[model samples]
Target: MNHTIIISKRISIYIIGLFLLSLGATFSILAGIGVSPVTSLPYALALTTPLSVGITTVLANFVFIILQAIILKEIRWKNFFIQLIISFLFGFFMDFTIWLTNGLPEATSLVLIIVYLAISLILVALALLLYFTANLPTMPYDSLTYVIANTWKIPFSKAKITSDMLNVVLSLVICLLFIQSFGAIGIGTFIAAYGIGKMVGVLLHKLQPSLKQWVYKNN
Candidate 1:
């Protein structure tokens, strides 16, 4: 009974984490400065195509899952299914958050931009806290970084950098060729690309112990 309760609690935290992640991403998008690195490609695609950013995010994540399968040469079918479900939920949460905040004042001034950026970073940090603590089926984009690092015998940091750079490059290409707009790739994109990880790390260092205590109190 204790084990089951623990599992249920963890699941709840994971779901909340995913929701927060989507919320942060939405803030970044609506900020109109730019998006985070992970969402950069999808944002670019959405700007050019008729698809909404949420749908594009789902499609992009699916592609990442496929890449993980190819790289790992095996698929954990159960975990893959869980990831798919989570991805769908993430996409939905993003769309829902966007809709919820649609009436908020426009992000026009430098102050709003900074506020949005700070909010995004804090939310992302808290989301990461829940996500890593839950220890659930990994998100495909995150899994890909692990697979690449393991397969290539490189440092995980290097692998992650490469993956991020590739996504940024793809986002840039799509914007240049199809959209002819750079609106989605701005200072915010660069900030997210270079700073989010470090910020998450700092947050983790400070918060992980308290979070662990809270979640594992019964253990």
Candidate 2:
């Protein structure tokens, strides 16, 4: 019974994390300034394609999983398949959140823009907190960086930076080739890419003790 309870708790945390992550990403996209770097490519694709950003995100993340498998030169078929299911769930949650907020007016005024940015940052930080705490199957984009870092024997931080830069570059290329405009890549993209980590770090630092206590007490 104890083991079952612990497993249930962990699964609940993971589901909450996915929910917050999808909502946060939707908030960023709806902000209309731009999306985070990890999402930039998908957002760009959505502009030219008929699919919504949520659907494009699922497809892009699937490709990321395939790339990770290729780079690792070995695949854990079970985990790979599980991650695909999680990715689809995340994508559907994102679409649902976007639908919920579809009636929100576009952020136009200076105050509204700042408010949107602040909300986006906070929600993303909270999402990261839940994600790291759950200790579940890793997201595909994150797994790609991990696989690359291990394969190249480079620092994970360096590998992650490289991955993000590559994502931005790829998004730019897609924009140039198809849209002939850079509307999807803007200041918010860079802010999200860089600021979110710092925000998550600070939040985790401040909340770690309390979070630990909660987990231990629950256990």
Candidate 3:
């Protein structure tokens, strides 16, 4: 049987990973502790301005893309199309997930909140790993990591962890000075800043072999 519609295996994995990433981010915010360091600045802007988290995320990603060009000293528009696509999809999925999970009750206890945080960390880490396995162009935030890593001749994980910490610090300043509140810098944020890095390291060790077999680009 010849099918009119076909999808690649890696694209399927990417979509699944994207949805999980959105759901994970939603749960993180709903936990009321904090957002992940990667998203903390966007969350702060969302709280301080009329823009939703999705809008802020989109905008922030665009900025990151620009930063990538600046750092690399060139613009490869053809190669960057996937990054642009993923950026828009990330925002859309995040907002859609927030609305879809609107019925979840607010966490009132520390235990429940911690559970949500744990789930958020794992989902995010897994989502990223899947993205790697898919072998697609990464989101700008991650692309920036590669830019930094290659530029400095350092490991990707080290670059990413350091970037996460720096982003958290920048977000904290934005929250206190402009947002006039703590924004999203709770204990969970700190945990995610460091913990997610460790989790991703451990997960990647197991994921590399599987990832070698998957190639995401469309033929």
Candidate 4:
């Protein structure tokens, strides 16, 4: 394939991934799942800062990229720019979805929450699907785990487990601070998040080949 053509194709897949990520985020929030690591930054900021969640997300990701650059020193233009664009896109869609769902009737609210959970779980699967479609850098969180493992000469699986545990603990802390002390977080949020992420990773791997091609060609 022509190099330019390949680049274009990858960008298209990334756009699709961005939409899926944004919708997944909406589902996560509505399902009351523990907030995603990156998303948690915005949630925390929302407590004290007057900024919107979407803006806060972009700001946090920018800071994260800077930190990664300083620490790893392998920050490439394509990967950094692509991640930034996708984060911005996801944030936009997330805000839209939240607005669309916030006004549901009582029964509708319950039904929507169930739908949110189901979609949130599947979104993780879709994420893996979308990830392989681009055949590019994994998400930033995964990339960090890889670097940490490689630098420390540890097994990738071990690194992944530790990273995930860190997120889990961090989520718990956020829940404690917000729902327990500050009184903002809710029940079932962290549990749903942790469970759905694991379930999705397992389920997605089984269907990776087909999902990868579909997300690549169809999207």
lDDT of 2 by residue, 20-120 (tens): 88788778877778788887877888887999877988998999999987887888899889889888988888789889889988888867777777788
| Steric clash pairs (candidate 3) | none
Question: TM-score of the candidate numbered 3?
Answer: 0.87
Could you give the candidate ranking by TM-score, starting with the highest?
Answer: 1, 2, 3, 4
Q: Tens digits of per-residue lDDT for model 3 on 1-219?
A: 112122366677788888888888888998898899888877877887899888988888888889889989999897577788888899999899889989887889988898888989999888877766776678889889899999989998899887788878878888899767778788888887777768878888987565644442223
lDDT of 2: 0.83
Give the whole-model CA lDDT for all candidates, comma-separated.
Answer: 0.85, 0.83, 0.82, 0.62
Residue pairs in candidate 2 whose N, alpha carbon or C atoms collide under 3 angstroms: none
Of candidate 2, the 10-residue stretch with the lowest lDDT total is 210-219
For candidate 1, write residues 60-160 as lDDT tens digits.
Answer: 88989899889888997887787788778887887888888798788899899888888887788789889999988878788889989999999999998
Which candidate, 1 or 4, has the higher lDDT? Answer: 1
TM-score of model 4 (CA atoms):
0.71
Cα distance off (Å), candidate 2, residue 197:
0.8
* lDDT agreement of model 3 with the native: 0.82
RMSD of each: 1.4, 1.4, 3.5, 4.1
Candidate number with greatest lDDT: 1
**Which residue runs does candidate 2 get wrong by more than 4 Å?**
none
List ranges where model 1 is wrong by over 4 Å: none
lDDT at position 30, candidate 4: 62
User: Once all C-alphas are superposed, what RMSD does model 3 give against the true structure?
Assistant: 3.5
lDDT by residue (5-112, candidate 4, tens digit) is: 667767776667666766666666666534555355555555455776677667766765665676677777787787687667666766776777677433246676
Using TM-score as the yardstick, the better of models 2 and 3 is 2
Q: What is the overall TM-score of model 2 with all chains considered together?
A: 0.94
